[model samples]
Target: MALPKEYVNQMRELLGEEAEDFLASYAEPKKTAIRLNGLKIESTGFGEKEAVDKPSAGQSFVAGRDPVPWAAGAYYTDKTERPGKHPYYYAGLYYIQEPSAMLPAELLDPQPGQRVLDLCAAPGGKSTQLAAKLRGTGLLVTNDLATERTKALAKNIERAGIGCAVVTNESPAKLAAAFGATFDRVLVDAPCSGEGMFRKDEDMVRQWDADAPARYAAMQDEIMLEAAKMVAPGGRLAYSTCTFSPVENEGTIARFLAAHPDFEIVATESPAAWGFAPGRPEWLTPEEAAALGPDRTARLADTIRLWPHRVRGEGHFAALLERAAPSGMAVSGASPESEPAGAAAAESRKAGGKTGGASFKDPKPGKRTTAVRRGAEAAGRGRSKGFDDRTGGESDTIARYEAFLRESLPGWKPPGTIRIKGDHVYAVSEPAGSMQGLRLVREGWLLGLSTRHRFEPSQALAMGLKPHQAALSLQLAGESEDAIRYLKGETLQPEPAKVTGLNGEPADKRGWTLVCLDGCPLGWGRWDGATLKNELLPGWRQV
Candidate 1:
């Protein structure tokens, strides 16, 4: 495994006596890990109570775990275990991630009920982590500039049972313009030269060039500037990268600090305490250091680096940044520019009384031409009443939706406005106008579809609910034949006793049933006296 000579030389110059060990560490097996989803499980010991049904001793998905020390709920798993193939994986019990990649979101520490953003959130690992911290309490607006990557991003959000997410596919500049310092916390996990990943992915080594860092540094700086604009006053921002490049890490911070006077780097505990190394201001060239000046250069040490040789995982870098609060403002209080919680009270600037804040403006002209024009007010008021006669779909669309909720999900109300767009129904957090003019992927939580006369609940809705949340539920042992059959999209003929209703209601063996694997909601099924028809999303069905 030959590294780029230029890169080796550079590392040697920067790491000195540590360079040999750092380069040799690449030959070792890459670490594999998973972060347990808090939205899905209560604690690390969740499977212990259900241990009786195990196919064999220690057969639980989390039976034996080697936890990642720096991150709670994250554990190191071996590659041979193939955790991805487990039924629990389909149930969204955990997320497969590199241990080092988990640090940024852990450091950002988004709280419940605070609006958060993952600016470069493609493939959504960090975004999902932040959403778990929110615990279904606040809005999570995750965006990626690449139009195609958002498909996976949306799937991951839904899979994790996250209901308060708004998925967007747009440029950072456009989002900054529309949101305007509205988020309580922001994460810009900037794309880099993949220098840090060279050990884990040989492809990155093949693709490396001498100029990669400088090229990516320019983009990272620009992205940071736009991301800075979206942070609320006194809000926190985290910048991170997978590359060990000084130009992309410390250099980018130095440049950003020089430009943005209202922001400062918050000091953190000693990096070694968390199996990390402090940022190296000494790595920057003399000219680069002079450009940053003495004060900011010294402050750069507050950032952290996770080296492949020093940590149990791959290499990564992360820095916490905070925007200064206005004079006399409390850190926890909302700033004047901040959008209020629920944001339903804010009047739309659009004419003729639209809700949210603006009409859906397609980022591209002539695309989404048939986009529905309902406001958040319609979703919040008319639809929730189960009689939204205004949107002009089928006359009984809302009636059907209401009936489903009452019968299947008796006590659970979709958190946001129930907006009907075409045949699709969404429980949207912000009014349609709030995201006006941005390219939208998913408006909010996709509740289901409103067909001609019936409301078909979506796989997303099923994944987002718990077993008790539904009126009727079918619980399958994680290793039972029934579980795999259901996951394969096969119908089942179960004993009437297997079907149970919420709060002592009689199990009639009819209507929609939330299907689960070991009490973890997998999807939905409809039981018709004799057979349980699988309603699992076809795309999600195990092959």
Candidate 2:
């Protein structure tokens, strides 16, 4: 690989005597790894008591390997392993991600039931990690400004069986204005000149230019300001990038700290333990450092750097910043009254039962209802698709949905505000109408489609459900022909005896079924006494 002279010169000044090792490290192979989806395994008690350390299904593939040090349930794999082709991968049991990229979400450490946001989330690796930490207990508003990019973002969230996430395609400024200081944790995985990924993706190297760092730094600073607005008082914000540029890393944090006095860089866990180095304040231009002042620039060392030469992964930089709160004001979530528009009354009326299964009550006429009607119209489908624009109102829709829940899930009660938009149904974790005008990719967990008198469950609904949650389920082994055929969208004639009830006894075998692979829920199926019809989403079918 021919290194760019300007980039080489910059690295030499940045690394000093370590430049040779940094340059030599590019020749090494890229690292490969996967994180087991606890949302899938733990909910079902699939393999072992502790699925994080010992994933029984993929043990043979990743056994005897030390897990990624900083990330739990993440295991390094050889490039030839091809875990993506396995049935479990289709089952949404794990996510494939590069090692260093996992650190930012871990640093943010969002807890269950706290509102979190991923500002630049797309193709959602970090967003899913945050969802796993939330454990379906909180709202995760994952957004990407790129409209086209949101397709992949929403797909990944659905594939992971994450019920609490709301995917959006909107600008950082719009999101900040809408949410206010509402989130407990916010992540800005800012875009930059892809210097860190050059070894893995040759296109990044081809796209690089000497002026990339300063250009990207300006955008990163702007993104950080918006991200700061969404974080609640006393909340934390985590900034990360896959570049080694000092202007984009320490300089960005220094500029932010100097501008926002309420925020400070908190030291992370020991940097040596993770093979991470301290942030380089010396790399900044003297003029830049002087403008930032001595104290602010000196605090930049609390940030982290994961050099390719020093770690087993690509180049990455991360910093954790906290917003100080006034006395008695460190709330984790914003009250409904504080939400934009008349969302407070919408929240009061939209309060729902477990599994979002309660009766639906429409909010009073005005902006909130108008927003709901507009969203529903935007998502409306014609009657040829089996949908009906009945004037029976939200109550009737909830009635049909409840019928399906009674027959299929039995007594399961998941949390979230239920939303009935045209023919589609969703269980949004955020308060109703809170995200009204944003360009929403998904309001929340898409329960299914409501067609005429029937409520059809979605592929997303299946991924999040446990074996026992469904009244009937079909369990298949990972290597079984039945599993592969099921993933391939092929109808099957499994013996009626193979079908089991919620109690594991011979079931009726004549209705909706939760399909599973080694006890992990895959998707939904409809089983008759003689044959099982495939209900897997066409887009997710195995090719």
Candidate 3:
């Protein structure tokens, strides 16, 4: 683990006596950590004495451990145990991530009901955190350049229990055209030369060189430009990288600021004040470094950097930028462009415009009308019936019916018996049972609708539940261990129990119900006939 001559000199100039000691300690990159998803399970309650005291409850590693208050629920432990085998991991109650990498999302401070974009999201670590911060409200668009990686990113987002998000595999240009100036916040967790990741992945060191930083800095510039276009006026953006090059850190930001005069760098407090040490300094121009003053000489004193040698975590960098109000420009609404040609047509047809009779189909007859009626009743209650037509014109009538169906049932598959009206598509589940207990799939979580059609939480949404309750929790006499296990954030059989309790009613008769433990919400479940089915909650399933 040899430090670059320039990096050593910069550190010596900055830290003096501490420089050599700090640089010598990085014998190797530190191992990664896994943090439980608090949205799925109450992480704060996990290690509490009262929680562990329960006769039926099992012990959680995070429980009773004194975590770094600033890094809530974060801890460093030996990786001797296989984390993937843990029940909580299987349930998507946590995610394996680099400890230092968590800083950017915390700094960005995402809130519910605010639209956000992750410009270079992939494998979705920070993006999922942003989703959790959003609390499933508003919209999150996560984009990645590599198509294959985007699929994995989407899966991670789904596992994290995110709803109201759009995942795209596209370049910055395409995203800019599709959704310019619409996000309240944008995250540019840009791709970079893996300097900071050297400790975690030694191969990165072998490939590292003086030119790598400059090369990545170029790409970072372009990515930041596209990111700027997507940020709404007064919105905030966080730029981060897992590299230790000033060219990729402050230099990149400086270039961006120079190009986009409407944006300004906002200073942030030290992680030290929050119980962590100040991070490494990427090389900076003498003037820029001087501006930080005598107390702090790290080139990025205004930004945050986490060095494993100093902070007991991986190395990373983050800077917060806020877009100033547009000058001499009228603020106007921005709508995302429609989907690609064929997909758009299909979507429109699904929305209920008659494309052709070929598009309409009635479900098999005599299957059962009760479930059909239930779905219809739920849909009717949620929407107006003014779109219905009296005349039963197949194409015209079904078109209108389909449109209504699309709105009422976002994921419903229209039955063949439905007819098309002028601009609407109408459909009834011929064998209504087929539509019974349809689960809402967003991200990857199965959304349980309350009797009032509101979403509630349940544990069935996590991926780590046991194949059978026996592997997860202590079974209460006469109750299905599987159901109890799912709520406990343990592994369980795919079959979940259908229970009723929106306002805490007796668990019976079911369409879907949110499962909870000790009154805390977990995720949602769907009941089909006599069986309760698991709809893994998004975000919570990414264990």
Candidate 4:
């Protein structure tokens, strides 16, 4: 690949003597990688084990190697291995991601209990990183424009074991309406022309042109505006892109600052205190350019601008902006009021479970109801029994179902606390706690929990004293050795097992048992009073 004259000139201005060499190297962007989920495995520990474990999922790790520097717990791969298919990938131990792509989340520094947003999240690389940063608390709203891509993003979030995120498919305007000035931090890792990715994805270069950055900048500006509105006053917003064009980098920031005086360009220091350079005044608007003299510009020097030639990662730009307090706007860290009635009801249905067709009784009138058939349909004609007899038939079925529900579950409402989307419902309770407990519904699965605690796990508090609790330690009749290994976290072939209580006795026990390694709960397993079944731990199951 040949460098454009503009790029060559820019490189010369940026790197002087090494510009030519940098251009030559740019023809093939080096592969930079990061471990999947750092919260599960530290980079240093993972790298040390990678040599013997060959962590690239059987992708060779070059026998003797050091860690990649751009991101912690990251390494460079020679494109000789398929890291994506490795067992660790399945376990969510680490995510294979580009080195530079990891920067925005790092810069945003999302912490526990902070409400954050990933405006253009899709296929969720950055959003997953942000989720890990949350450490499983607070809300993370990850939105994307494409429906198909949003599904992929949601799956990655699930595989990563992220619990408090709400993924939405909507435009920036819709999101702003639903959640205005709500987030503690907002990230606009907006869509942009693929300049930095060109080296890795050659097709990008074929489609690139000078005008692409300008076009993308226009979209980015709108996204940044929406981002500003959603960010709480005194909160922060980090805008970034993978392209090197000034039009999409400093130029975009400059334009935004010009339009929104309430946001200030906050300087950020490096993690190691190496420091950063300020945005170039030449790229700023005339007014902004004059607001800072050479000396004041020097004071604003910690804004980041990472170049491929200068940094060990891909070409990327990021700037952190702090929202200034708007007059009379409360900055008390309150969340926005509940969503509108009909939208709330729609969201409730999407959350999964049976909606009673009655709207909420709140004075706000934020919920609406719609009715569909209530019970299982007739079999052969592929139609429900109520189809031929809508009025009396369906009504009778619903009444009977409601009566049965009332008798069996006195205080329980239908498992309506979950919002089902596609194959899964974001439940306020674990599906297992519901009356149907583990039964599959059209919504895929039903999860139950205490209404007060939402769906947070209580560690099977009841199991702590169950008569068969000890049965969790039972061994398979023919595979005692294998059972021991399984308890020790070793990989074992599937086999049948006989279940017995801790005292070596058996009863009519049929339910899930919690397996522990030296008293530390490993995960849950099922017992049919005879055979034991395993449900992989959220983080320990891959092996």
Candidate 5:
């Protein structure tokens, strides 16, 4: 791939002698990875939020190795390992992300119970990590300017079993005005000139020009102004970018600190401590510092940058800033002492933990998992596609949903408080903002659908459940042909004697059961006499 001349020139100056080494990194294959979902894992039975070190499904899930240095529970997978094609991916066991892309969220270090926000979340890599950091204890509101992208963000969050999040499609200015220093931790993974993505996405090279960085720098300033407003006093605001441009990385931070003196750059966990380099304020000329002041340039050293040559990933930059002035918008999460891991969460990530996927243990069908058909005005279809349009939360809908829950889940209490919209039902774990006009992609835990006549659970809801949680369940072993068949949306017969069937025998009755691979719930499926119908979503099917 030919390097963009302007981009190369800019990086050449920014990197000095190291520029050659940095540019040469593009020749090496990029590192691929997945961060485990801490929230989706089993918690300590001792009534605390700490997750167990191992998965109940066993160790076959984490069969591969090479852990990322920043994101905890994240490991570099083989480049060809298309986890998206696996049942565990649909089960929300982990999120596939570029290694350097995981650094900023790790540096943010959100605790289990604090209110947080991701100012520019889309395709949800960082937001999911934030959800894992929160461990289902606090509110996390993630936003993107475009409503279309928020759909993917919402799915990734829900798929990862996060119920405390509210995904929104709105501008930073509107959110800042509405929130007003409300978050304990705020992340701005600003969109940049794609200098870092040239290798991974060749189109970025076609789009790049000398003018792109300056254009992005201007936009970053506008977005940063609003992001700063939403930071609570004493709260931390983490800013990051994938571009190597000084104008966007250092210059933008310099301008923000100068614009808001009450906000100061605080030293974040440095990958440099592990051999990566820090951000260079010296890259900015004296003229640039004139606007941000002289000290602003010196403080830039506090920020960190991940170079592709230095690390086994693409370029990325991160800066941690604290709002020193009291704005009263500060919300508290878990005390710092109780946070699960440090900014460099990799050091503390649990190693050798098992994962959920392809279960073979056929549930002993003792109880029937049938929801009674309720009479109502509209026997409608829920947002099975995941981009909700606010239609289901009526009183009748709630009642019907509860009835279904009782039948399907039995004694399992929902993780969040229930609320309905259209045919959709949600279990909200934290207090949500009014967000009246903003396009809210997801408000809480999307439990399932409840039309006038039928009630159906969601793929997202299935991922979080255990085999025992459902009234009926089918478990499969890891790497089994049956497991692959089930994930491929193929129906298969179960050995009648292996799993005790409901109503006397396997051929005697029919109902819905949670389909599992090992102990991980794949999704919902229906059984009819001799065969189990695949309920795995078409888009998510392995085949």
Candidate 6:
């Protein structure tokens, strides 16, 4: 794989003394990593039954052998193993990720019970991490301008069993208009020139050019400005890129700070711990950014730079920022004297700021808002065209669905509002006030769909369930050949002796069955007395 000459020339100039090492690092094999679902950790509760941390401890996904220094429950998977092909992959156990790509979410550091947003979440790697950090307590809105791409985002979020997030397919401006200053922390993993992707994908090298950086930098400028608006006054926004172009990195950060001094670059957990380099402010020349002043250089230095030569993974850049105004940390309906928890509240306390003191407060669930979005409001209050929010659907859909939840998931309780749109049913994490205008592809958890006679659980719902919650469950070993067949949507015919009723007595009776590998669901199946019919979604079938 040859590096582009102009790109090489540009990097040579930027790297100064380290250009040779930078180029040489590409010859080495790229590293592979996976992050276990922290929501599955022992005490974290997304389900009635806790997901065990280690396979030896209980029925859960196996943690990788070596831990990545910067992320908890994240590890460097063996290069020899096909981690993506493993049965646990279908079980929402872990996410395959590029090691350095994990940095932005870590720096953003979302906490439990705070309102958060991922401004450009797609393919949902970072969004899943943010969801795990939220621990199913706070509201997480994952939005992207590309409407089609959010499907992938929604699927991954579902596979991970992230219940707190509301996935939207709206542009940054519309999102800001609908949710101004409501997010406690917002992440803008801005779209970039893909120079950092050259290592893993040679195609990106073929497409590189001198002009692409400037084009993307201009795009980032608009998105960051809008994203900044969504962050609560006391909230923080994390801007990151997978590219090394100063135009998209320091130059963009410098320009934004110039336009909004009310927001300042702040320190994130030290990047040095993972061999990450610091941002080069000098890389941004006056010609590149007219508004950039002297102080911009010093402030931009706070941003993190992960270079291939300096780190074990592909290159990346990040800048953590905080807004100056005071904002509340408590959820709406909590007392004025109530205190907030997590990073946002801690930072507010450190700054001696008051919560809800400046324009931002907890959002009330299930209401309409025009002035500003409350940080506490759960997503999906938008009224879609086909569904009746009043009746929960065409005919008693909410009632039938709620009854299904009661029967299917014993002891299951609605975390927040449950709304139905068309045939789709959503379990909202926060109050979804009037989202009449925004293009919301998904809000809260996609519980399933409502039909005339009964409600069917989504694959997402099955993935989110505890093994025991299902009426019928089959926990196969991770390496079991049946596990492989199960992922392929193949039927399993266990010995008649082992075939027992869902209640663990005699053989017979069943509807939907939850298939699992070590107690985590692979997908849903049906029991027709003789065979366990695989209901795994076609797209998820193992090739």
What lDDT does the true structure give each of the candidates?
0.74, 0.74, 0.52, 0.51, 0.69, 0.70
If both were scored by TM-score, which would come out higher, candidate 2 or candidate 3? 2
| Winner of 3 and 5 under lDDT | 5
Q: What is the lDDT of residue 408 in candidate 6?
A: 59
TM-score ranking, high to low: 2, 1, 5, 6, 4, 3
Best TM-score among the predictions, by candidate number: 2
**Root mean square deviation (Cα) for candidate 5:** 9.4
Ten-residue region with minimum lDDT total, candidate 4: 375-384
Off by over 4 Å in 3: 1-17, 28-31, 42-59, 66-69, 273-282, 286-300, 326-543
Q: Estimate TM-scores for all models.
A: 0.86, 0.87, 0.62, 0.63, 0.84, 0.82
lDDT of 6 by residue, 1-543 (tens): 688889889889988889999989889888778876755533222112333453242223332255566665566777798988876676777899998888888777765666788989998999988876665666788888887798788878878877777888999898888877777779999999988898789989888888999999999999998988787766778899999999999999988988897887775445465587888888877754557667656778778898888777888998888777633333332222223324333332221221111111112211111222223211222222223224445467777777776655666565666666667777776543346698878766666666556666777777666665665666677668888888887888755434344565544556667777665677777776668888777767788
Question: How many steric clashes does model 3 contain?
Answer: 62
Model 3 lDDT tens row, 248-298: 887777667657767766665553644344434445566645554434343
Q: What digit string (tens of lDDT, one per residue) describes model 5 on residues 1-543?
A: 788787778678767898899888888887788777665444211111234574344334554466576656677789878888776676676788988888887777776567789989998999988876665566788889977787687777767766667778899988876778767789999989988898789899899888898899999999999998887677778899998888899989988887898887776546354456888888875767887877767889878888888887887888988777444433343555434332223222434232211111112211111111111100111145444433345776677677877766777777556666676777765543457677667666667876546566777777666666676777677667888888788987876443323332333445667877655667778776567878777755776
Model 5: CA > 4 A from native: 41-58, 61-64, 271-273, 325-396, 497-510
Clashing pairs in 6: 328-355, 328-356, 365-431, 366-431, 378-430, 378-431, 381-432, 382-435
How far does residue 223 in candidate 2 sit from its true spot (Å)? 0.5
Cα-lDDT of candidate 5:
0.69
Query: How well is each residue in 80-120 modelled by candidate 4, as lDDT tens digits?
Result: 76766444454344577876787777667654546788988
For candidate 1, lDDT tens digit of each residue in 1-543?
789899999999889999999989888889989877766664223423334654322134555666676665677898788877778888887888998898888778765566888999989899888876665665788899998898888888878888878889998899988888878789999999998787678999999999999999999999999999988887888999999899999888888987887877777664464467989888777877787678878878888899998999898999987888777765553323324312311221111121111121212211000111111111100121122324356446677788889888887767767676765678887531258888888877777766655787877888788788888988788668999999898999887878889964549647999888777788889998778998877778787
Better of 1 and 6 by TM-score: 1
Return the lDDT, model 5, position 329. Answer: 39
